[model samples]
Target: MTPPNTGRRSEASRRAVLTAALDLLQEVEYAKISIEGLASRAGVGKQTIYRWWPSKGAVIFDAFLMLSEGAEGGPVQLPDTGDLAADLTEVLRATVTELNEPRYEQPMRALATEIAHDPELAAIYAERLDGPLREAKRQRLRRAQRAGQLAEDLDLDVAVDLIWGPLFQRWLHRSGPLTTEYADRLVATALDGLRPRR
Candidate 1:
């Protein structure tokens, strides 16, 4: 049985490990990060890292979670100004900007690469990272539903996916630049289909 103080120290060490992982990911590609290197950068023993995480991918997952602060793009709450188009436009535009930020880009790429290779990590990433953002968007859609701004038959879950899909695709594939104008167009297209006609 570990002492109560042991839990605190463990949490602190975990935080340090995550911080170091993020730093390393920024400095070097994901393929090069190692548990031993993470331990050194975190100022923790290698044994400590092994005691918690099984692989560097797991460390990257935790690091992404920490960097996202349990939410995507900053705050978790979606704006509900009663104007669904405007609110979604603002949110997606901000997401575009956040995805492009240098500090966030590396971890985002690392997480994506990790998920591609590891199914378990993919699940964890969805639970910790994608789920919260999806839920927030769902809640906002529900608000629009309540306001009768959106069609009663509008599938909230799919709608959320639809709104986010293009943004994620662009960011993940680097197919094109994400911009406020792109977000605005996406909002217009999505809302035109979902919103109640005048």
Candidate 2:
């Protein structure tokens, strides 16, 4: 029923739409962005965008995902040097740098703002972005726990929340500079309680 060229055109249009959506997000806050603008910037008909995504929020999320490569640009696996403090400190420091990068900041903020007002977008984002990141962190923490580097009684998920929550709060709220020093402090405070002690 569909021509072979149809699939190629659809893919091309989708990419253009996503690229335009990301560009617009950088220039305008999420609340102010519109489908008409996205279509014009993308050079596609409004119908093309609506066919692929239900909302601008969905387009923005997909764009972020594509840019980050699904958050795989960072360390693929947690550093397990058998030293919990060092490993966590290194990871958090890298995370701070990643969050502070201008390329990631605006779009991330846009997505966060969109999620707050839209439950459906929040659910999709959780499944695509949040869930993967949480799972990776949990797996890393579990490794530390099994190595006796972390306390046997420590809850990995809660521990991850404790360590990462402050960083997220700072980035999302613009509360403070997300520096290596700040990340180190977070890791230190969280590890002080988590690390196995004599």
Candidate 3:
């Protein structure tokens, strides 16, 4: 059986460890990070970090997850202006800006690289981070459906992917510029395909 948790102090240590992981990731390549480094930077014992996280990849993934959830330190929620296209565009444009920001971009790239190589870490990321974010996207899409902006028959999962996939791909591959104009076009194109037919 697992031991009982240490409540607030443990939570504080976890936050410190995560913050240290992000700071180290930004300063050095992912491959260079180690448990010793993280523990030292966080001012926690190596055992403490190991007790909570299984590996350096998990630590880095969690750090990225926290920042992605909210760069300004608040919960991230999609806007429900009752305008589906506009809402998506606004979110995507904000994503573009965040992706361009050095603080978010570098750590994100590290986490992405780690996820690609570590299947277990990837599964954790999908469950903890991607799942909630996708659900939120679906919720916004559902609102659009209710508002008569999207077709009732549309698959919310596929719709979420269809809308977010391009921006992600572009960012991952550096395929093209992620400008607001591009975001607008993506929303317009996706909405055109998703809207109810006459």
TM-score to true structure, per model: 0.86, 0.89, 0.81
Better structure of 2 and 3 per TM-score:
2
On TM-score, who's better, 1 or 2? 2
Stretch of 10 with least lDDT, candidate 3: 68-77
Task: Please give the distance, in angstroms, between residue 53's alpha carbon in candidate 2 and its true position after superposition.
Answer: 1.0
Please provide, for model 1 over 136-183, each residue's C-alpha lDDT reduced to its tens digit, 9 standing for 90 to 100: 889989988988988899899889888989999999998997899999
lDDT of 3 by residue, 17-58 (tens): 999988887898778889999999999999999899888888
Candidate 2 per-residue lDDT, tens place, 23-86, comes to: 8877886777899999999999899888888887788888888888865876457777777788
| Cα-based lDDT for every prediction | 0.86, 0.84, 0.85
Task: Please count the clashing residue pairs in each candidate, in the order shown.
Answer: 0, 0, 0
At residue 106, candidate 3 shows an lDDT of: 75
Residue pairs in clash, model 2:
none
Question: Quick one: ranking by TM-score, best first?
Answer: 2, 1, 3
